[model samples]
Target: MANNLQIASAAYIVMHLLTKKKQSSIKKRRWWTTQIFRSRQLYNGTSMIRDLNFHTDSGQFENFARMSQEDFEHLVSLLTPIIAKQTTHFREPIPVNERLAVTLRFLATGESYTSLQYVFKISKQCISLIVPEVCQSLIEVLKEYVKVIINTFINNSK
Candidate 1:
């Protein structure tokens, strides 16, 4: 009985030591480790802006959005005044061109706000506010254009 008790105590100590040794040898996987963090830091919102290379040989801008480069620029010019940052407390004002481009991309692609947040590097809340505001500005600016299109449709039908 005495010999068995000694063997059991020795076995328990050995198992504990072995378990501690294994734990010390095993490397921990951490998501926020410097190596993983550096890789994730490489993502920038600026890179999310879609290609606007109007001068490129492929004409990707026009083909993708069904609008000429000039028309897009004209639209941006008109909306800039209305959508430009009026006053910001702490945040930097988003550039009018960026705002217009993001709104246009959202409208053209029908992308959701969450996707746009990643693409534009802007917050979803900001995007939610921007899309409607820009659309309203567009409606206000294009009232005349809308009337022309409606009249043209009516006249063509007649």
Candidate 2:
């Protein structure tokens, strides 16, 4: 048992060493290590930190309700324009990659909050803040685009 555990730990350390250079240079190594440690603590024995990415607290993300794909795309379109404006105004909002990941997760699975935390590698609190803001932005700015689609749909239904 001890030998197997040692081998696994050695393998992980090797992988982490290789990946770290490609990932980011650690300026404050201690701080980054400490932060990572604390974040892992949030799992409270639930998360399994393996060789590569840790799958922590994965959960099902069934939509409480359902909607058509058109409705979903329209929602995304509605927010895209507004997101540009709002994101620009902030000195530095969440990074674009993070934003894209969040948006894609919502579109893909319509996941609940906890599943999102693990999948996106973000805190549940952060997800709480971002998802709603994006949703509102989508609704407000895509008025013309949505209107055109809605009008076309109405005509087709006739």
Candidate 3:
């Protein structure tokens, strides 16, 4: 899970989109599902409510969404040229365009890998491999943008 204060601006934007998803999902969920969640809780009343692990929204929601849609579009535009160009050797370069969309769908829905296999018409293992590979590649690819933000934050504090 990402620390709220430390999330890159891009990640924060993604989290906001996630919040809207979470609310809709909760509303559509069956009553039995909510009961299961309630039973799992060890609660203290009066603002001490706690839920396990990261959901679509976490501390990021404590702040209202401040970034505008234009700003978000600008960010994605900045990231739009995401083609990887390496050719040391390859019988097959990953067809990243299709892979990225499928992985994003999985992340947004939290759908199980088995479910994805049927949707993607690939084996479960391939789906599993593509997801992590996408994650690792995104981390590396976004390092410059994310690191600049992080480093500026660190320098500002001192």
Candidate 4:
């Protein structure tokens, strides 16, 4: 009876080892799953702008946005409070700098929604939602600045 008990214990150990080996050897094709694919989707906000050196490369940045970096900063500062209030704490708020850059790119280049998505690594739905919101915010924030610039331009032309 002792030998029988020892044999049963050895068989159980062997079976457990085999099960672990099989589990480890099996290649999981988890990369093909929707969850994995979704996780791999690119997200570009503040870092994208920084990586592209929009702050440092004044010439390229101005060419892309049709506005100087100083003006861009001013616009972002003006719009920050409004956009900040609109954003909730539920999810990460896209930075005011990114929103302003994306809006300026769209307005300056007349780029399509699809193109903007590729450029910004943002979803089409989000881009569509953001563009209008930023535009409206810009109108509200820059109204006074626009008036001053227009007045200066008219006076200079005289």
Candidate 5:
């Protein structure tokens, strides 16, 4: 009888522990959990891309991004169709222009995703995903331009 009681008690303890472990593993999902992510719009006005003032200061913009404002805008336009995302009920998607700017800034400065997170007011995880996707899109969109350039060079050589 004592052994039976001990077995029951051990089983109960095991069950209780399992239940507690399951509860702890289940995390709650919330929209915009961090203050920094929520303040992205407020920081946008003072962001590197905007504060550089593409029209008024092309030299500064070019220096910062390693590309002129026109080239930046042209790249944005070319990649927009491929990279654009739809806004959902939960939140608006990050704009294509912002994604391109982030990728270009990363390429130009070789800054880590963590450093860019604070500058762009975006999460490092999001920036990590954005950079690769934008780079692939750039390669895809620029292929035609590359082909044209190669063809022109060949014709001139001949």
Candidate 6:
């Protein structure tokens, strides 16, 4: 009878441990999912993009993004149609200018996506996606200028 009780107790302890382990795993998963979908408002509120009045501070803007404000605005205008996203009910889309700024900063600084995420309040995943998409858009939109430059160079050489 004692041996049976010991066996039963061991079985109960094993079952309890398994239940606790499952619960902890579920909790971890919930936390991870919440993190993935968490609001960017907190980060955005303190983000460099929001805090810096770069428009008024052209020098600072140039330092940060490696481009003058005028050129930045021009790029934004040219790229907006290609990069712009529609706002959804869940969240407003990131602005075109912000996307361009992030891409330019990445190009200028060669900062890791993790660091950029902190500065821009955008997820690294989003940054990774934004950088490549913006770069491709820039190539497509700027190919005409490249061609003109190449043609001028060849003509001048001749």
Rank all candidate structures by their TM-score, best first, as comma-separated numbers.
5, 6, 4, 1, 2, 3
TM agreement with the true structure for every prediction: 0.57, 0.37, 0.36, 0.59, 0.74, 0.66
On the 0 to 100 scale, the lDDT of residue 83 in model 6 is: 89
- CA RMSD of all predictions: 13.1, 20.9, 26.1, 15.4, 6.5, 8.8
User: What ranges in model 3 sit over 4 Å off?
Assistant: 1-94, 147-158
Q: Which stretches of candidate 1 lie over 4 Å from their true place?
A: 1-51, 86-89, 148-158
lDDT of candidate 4 over 1-158, digit per residue (tens): 99999999999999999999999999978553344224323556566655656768648667767888788888888888898645576545667887888888888878988888766666667779889999998888778666547778889999
lDDT of 3 by residue, 84-129 (tens): 3344552233344335544665776788988765544444676788
Global lDDT of each model?
Answer: 0.73, 0.54, 0.51, 0.75, 0.85, 0.80
Candidate 3 matches the true fold with a TM-score of 0.36
How displaced is residue 9 in candidate 6, in Å?
34
Model 2's alpha-carbon lDDT is 0.54
Using lDDT, give the best candidate's number. Answer: 5
What tens digits encode model 2's per-residue C-alpha lDDT throughout 51-98? Answer: 112222222221311333345445546455455434465233544334
Candidate 5 regions off by >4 Å? 1-20, 27-31, 45-47, 147-158
Better of 1 and 4 by TM-score: 4
Ranking of predictions according to lDDT: 5, 6, 4, 1, 2, 3
Model 3 scores worst on lDDT over the 10 consecutive residues at: 44-53
TM-score of candidate 6 on Cα atoms, chains taken together: 0.66
Clashes of each: 0, 2, 0, 0, 0, 0
1-158: candidate 1 lDDT, tens digit per residue: 99999999999999999999999999877652344223423543333324456656467777655677778779889988788886577445766666776788888889899887766666778789988998899899998887547877889999
